[model samples]
Target: MVIKPKSLLKNKALNKWNLFWLISGPISIFMIINLLAVDTSTGAGISEMIQFSVRWAVPFVYLVIATSSVQILFPGPFSRWLMRNRKYIGLCFAVAMAWQALFIFIMSYFFHEYYYSDVYYFRDEIEGSIGYIFLPAMVLTSFNFGSKLLTPKQWKLLHTSGIYFLWAYPFSVYWWNLYYYENPVLIDYVFYWVGFVAFALRIVAWGKQRYELSKRIDPNYKTPIESKMLGGLFIIFGLLVSASGLYWQDLITSLFTCFSMVRRT
Candidate 1:
């Protein structure tokens, strides 16, 4: 009798573990390369390495937060997949951000003389520090056991506020760079807009849910189809924006460079 091989991807119980490895494995490899292969002889190289890590990881962070909103906006196989795997996606995001934080710590503390210039100090003092405070709180509460410590309302408030705070980091960074430094990278714009769209989607969904709840108390209240239509429009707009961003040569080059750097190292 022929026996079928067990597939790790098909195992639902191990979904979180699979996500952990999927996200962490590449990040770990990149960190190793930065430590070993990247020429950190100059402070500029170290700064570039740090920026590289942040840019690559920010998309995944946005994606994790977008999962719920995306599911609400587009109810289908893709949306269902996102909803089913949201917990793992969120955990993976925390892991990715933790990796980014480690790189920042090393840069600030160990290579302070080389990397911690005036700009770095100013940025960290103003924004990075605030962002870091929320990171640990969100990460800790991401697990089921940790979440149980807080009332459902408390948990919702913390995560909702935490994600908004974290979202500000990339938005502020890219906007500041775009306006002040004149570095018009397509990917940065994509990240900023995607973050905005995700937040907007959530707000709309929440408002609609509340309206629906209130309608239950009234006999004449009717559910509107406009919400679904609006959701569909949002999903379509998101896909179009993402596709346009992916077509940019500069963004493609940057992604390839990042991957090649890791591969070569």
Candidate 2:
């Protein structure tokens, strides 16, 4: 007699709110522990916690960005699972960002000079304020109550714009860290590539999608992998050059440091 192993992908209870809690509960615990380990009595401590929360929050947003692409590129049980839980995953990001918001408020109120001088930049403030605005707007519109107010096209535009903006922020952050920053952390490399690859997958999937659409439009129209292969080559060459930046730091520092993120460093 053979005993079949249980497949988690088939489990209905594992998605939705259950999935949200399962992922978020441990994240919250670690976040609290991180808070305790820090000296939160000072502005710097609160600031550090804010960065920590961002690290915690970003992975969920990555999942949100890539899940649909994952389904498009490689449809399977795991991809389906990711697709089903996308909304809940988004909720997890909102909750984590809420934590950062709390810390931001604490720092701005109690450590005004530190928050403004050390943490705030007018350009970054504008970017982040736009993000904050999109955040709650996306959250509210995720549900039926808020969603019903918008037309389907409007709703789709809101989410698509918000997710891409959200993806761009972190991807740019890590890209700057990897390409321009001094003493970039190991996690900086990890997050940069992970974000890079996730978006890359979406690009590949889009190419494949357009290829398929073209064929459907004209069955006799022949298509070659030239575009796809060329696209892949560009990605490879770009990665090699970008990865080579570490050994040639002097070139970038002189050229790009003055242009450093308006207060992002």
Candidate 3:
């Protein structure tokens, strides 16, 4: 039997609406499981469950933010598919985040004693609130009707800054944990660096596009080879950082599994 080519295997005809539900259905199911499985009897359990929900939501948020950057870096079938379905992906992220917010509200209602007293709440009031402020605006403008109300420049400004704001919340959280926590999780460190790389790539892409536009306006202006060199340097640095992060992640996972087994035995 002949193996199918990757190009042939790629689903170029995916409907965005169907794609949205396909991605969101599993997430909704996962949230349901978290809601059922979390021990809601204690404040600690509620805190753990809230973290679980937020952790699960983070990847989708990162994907929605990184979708355009990824497409810019690698133009291919997968990237094209991502570009086409990005709005749906953002919607999925919004749904997940909204559920996470609901869990937070429930925690505040039931475990007000701890929730109000915790330093986490105070920190969240600053960092998390700012991030949440962008969510509703971004989500509302994501639809055609809402987008139509804004000029093209206004829409672009809203989303460009909104994505960065959303990106910063998780990045800052993970970066802080990596620095201040005695024992930071490998995944958190990985995510922090991954967000950094994504942001860097986005800047590089934007700069390149802007430079091209400038060149078009001023034909006499020489293309800046130095800027290209800097971008190449950044890509190299990013790849090295990503490689090390993944390596450490695997090493830590293996050690943790071994330690768990030893404890069980």
Best by lDDT: 2
Q: What's the best-to-worst order under TM-score?
A: 2, 3, 1
Per-residue lDDT of 176-211 in model 2, one digit per residue for the tens? 787677788988988888887788778878877987
Q: Which candidate should be chosen as best, given TM-score against the real structure? A: 2
- Model 1: lDDT of residue 205: 69
Per-residue C-alpha lDDT of model 3 across residues 208-264, encoded as one tens digit per residue: 678778889997877679877887897788677554653465577689999999999
lDDT of 2: 0.86
Candidate 1 clashes between residue pairs 3 or more apart in a chain or in different chains: none
lDDT of each: 0.70, 0.86, 0.77
When 1 and 2 are scored with TM-score, the better candidate is 2
Separate clash counts for every candidate: 0, 0, 0
Model 1 misplaced regions, further than 4 Å: 1-14, 114-118, 121-123, 214-265
